[model samples]
Target: MQGAWFAFILTLLAGLSTGIGSLIAFFARRTNKTLLAVSLGFSAGVMIYISLVDMLAEARLDLLGQYGQPGEWLALGAFFAGIGLTALVDLLVPEVENPHHAWRVEEMESAAEAARARKLLRTGMVTAMVLALHNFPEGIATFVAGLMEPATGVAIAMAIAIHNIPEGISVSVPIFYATGSRRKALLYSCLSGLCEPLGAAAGYVFLLRFVSPGIFGVVFAMVAGTMIFIAFDELLPAAHEHGEHHHAIGGLIGGMAVMAVGLALVR
Candidate 1:
């Protein structure tokens, strides 16, 4: 139980990366496109590798114990179900306030001059909500992984933390622009990421009964599918929008290499 609490704290640390994003937004004069592209790509790589290699295999191990060959198929089905669930949410929720949207220099300056305060505040708040929704499953993943393995938990948490930075930017930038209150924007952004920890706590409380290797594998596959979708649908497009495809690809490879090494060491 004490270990679980400790692991849980690590998960919280991983998910609170919105705070990092908020701080960066408060300090940065402009978005660092190269950095963003690389980091986002790197996150995608970590998630993909871990989900496929470690998580899915764990799930198979657990499910095979209970259901044999049928269990393997069920795990795959559940994996698809997880992907479908996230995709459905993404589809149902209109992306009216995507954080990845870049502003042209002149457009930004003009908006600065022309926009009212309320609009920016509203935008920030909405960004928070969108990000919170996006981050819920990540919290679950971190909590579950941490509970299962401490070192792997740290790696998963780090990956999630790296991924949360952009989301923080998503929440802070608009709020700062809208209200010109750096503090408020940062606060909101940080709060938005807190949802992840909350998700972790809730998932931990409710999901222990289902925590078998097969279930883990299916969930991992589902998460992998969701991440791949986000990489292509969100991260890659955003990276390209910043005009740094090579950097993003390089980051992707680096992320994969690091995770590969971590897995090898753990095994």
Candidate 2:
């Protein structure tokens, strides 16, 4: 019960971190492109390294224990399935409104064109909705990681939280521009983040009745795949878009190093 509570709390904090981004968008005078770029790259590095080194290995072990040699293939299939699921979600969201499409604080100025206000509002709303959809699986991934290993969960949650900041900015910029209301922009940004916790709750309720080693293994692998997809498809590109290539790469290496050290200490 305590562990479950802890896991839920972690998920909640991660989800709410989006609000931090919204706040940053509202208050920051200038867009810190280099910092944003490095941060995004760092997040990507953490997710990619942890997903491959820790989550995948853990999943393989659990599956092997449950199903012998065939478990290897099963883990592989599930990993790809996770990637496929996220990809499908991405495909469903129009490219224009996809939350992964990068936005910065500077854009807020340009977004305020009076003629485009209505269009901007619609874009913000659609982005919020799309972001909610994307966050659902991420919520599940974080919750499951918490249940399996608290330390890993913390790492995953932090990485997710970092990535989500940009998402909040993405949702808020257009909305604030359209509505001329910081409150509305912030509200919508936070609402989109709420989906993360909602997803965690939903996934937990459903999985509880069917909990087993095989199920755990499959889910872990899928989560790993999802992380990998986000890292490569979203985080890296967005990082590069925000700043210099070398900055992004440096941050990536720094992130991996930090995670590696943490893992070593914990082990």
Candidate 3:
């Protein structure tokens, strides 16, 4: 019971980090493009590094132990399946209202801006919905990882939290601009974040009963794939779009270095 509660709290904290982004949108004088870029890059680096080195390796070990060589292919297949699912979500969402879009707070501060903000509102809402959906599996992944290994869970939560900061910023700025309601903006951001805990709860209640080392390993591989895809498809591009190439690259390296060190220390 304590372990489950701990997982819930960690997942909840990660989800609520979006509120941090909401606060940033409301208070910051200007969007720190360089910081955002480097941060996103760093998020990507950490995610990619973990997927390739830590989580994937864990998955391979467990699968090989359980089902011999065939389990190896199964784990690898699960990783690709994750990428396909994310890609399908991207395809289902409309291009104009794509969830990956980011906007600045200043752009939405004027009455004259309402027209532009209206368009952005659709994008923000759509992004929120998409993010909520994306976060569901992530919540489960985090919960399960935490249940299995607290240290890995903490690391995963940190990486997810870092990227979610930008997501919160993306969700809040436009909606606030469009409706001129901080309450509404914060509500939406918080709601989207709530999905993480909801996902964790659901996954625990329904999925935990069936978990085995093999199953856990497979899910870990898939989640690793999901993070890698998110980093490449969303974080990197967004970072480059918002900030300079050099800053983004530097952040990416820094993030990888940090994650590597964290894993090493845990080991």
Leading candidate by lDDT: 2
Per-model TM-score on C-alpha atoms: 0.87, 0.96, 0.90
**Residue-level lDDT for 90 in candidate 2:** 80
Clash counts for the predictions, in order: 5, 0, 0
lDDT of 3 by residue, 1-267 (tens): 788888888899889888888998889867778888888898888878888898888988999999999989988998888788767766776675555665455644442255686786886688789778877877877786677677777877887788788678778877887788989889899888889899889878865678766888887888788878888988888888888999989988998899899889988
The TM-score measured for candidate 1 stands at 0.87
Clashing pairs in 1: 58-213, 59-213, 59-214, 59-217, 120-178
Task: Give the residue spans of candidate 1 off by over 4 A.
Answer: 100-110, 209-229
lDDT of each: 0.71, 0.89, 0.80
RMSD of each: 2.7, 1.3, 2.3
Tens digits of per-residue lDDT for model 1 on 1-267?
876796689868876777787777666667777887787778767766776676666666767777899878876777667677767766755566655453222334345567677876776687688777777766776776777667667777887788777777777777778877878877888888887788778867766767654555565555555555555566666656665789888877888899999889878
Q: Which has the higher lDDT value, candidate number 1 or candidate number 2? A: 2
